[model samples]
Target: MARGAIPPLPVWAGEALDLITDMPSAEDLVTAMATQAEGALIRAGRR
Candidate 1:
């Protein structure tokens, strides 16, 4: 391999990257889940 050439990724690493690309931002996901949890709790009279 030439100097500074990128090495091949293992199969799992490539799959993990693909999954990560499809995910929403962490902040957005957390906010969405937290909102859902709050709504559920409100429906159950807990919050």
Candidate 2:
């Protein structure tokens, strides 16, 4: 941070900054979630 109030940063936060600043890919998200099906464990914890 410019203010010096905060210690610089951890390695993972720097890496996450790059990832969060970039645009997310919808198709990639869908592909990644393909294994999860509708009505499958949607609310298992509450049940």
What would you estimate as the lDDT of candidate 1? 0.92
As for model 2, its CA RMSD to the true structure in angstroms is: 8.2
Instruction: Judging by TM-score against the true structure, name the best candidate.
Output: 1
- TM-scores of the models, in the order given: 0.54, 0.29
Candidates' C-alpha lDDT: 0.92, 0.67
lDDT per residue for candidate 1 within 1-47, as digits (tens), equals 68977767786699899999999999999999999999999999999
lDDT of 1 at 17: 95
Q: After superposition, how far is residue 23 of candidate 2 from its true place, in Å?
A: 1.9
Quality of model 2 by C-alpha lDDT: 0.67
lDDT of 2 at 11: 61
In model 2, state the lDDT of residue 45: 50
What TM-score would you give candidate 1 relative to the actual structure? 0.54
Best by lDDT: 1
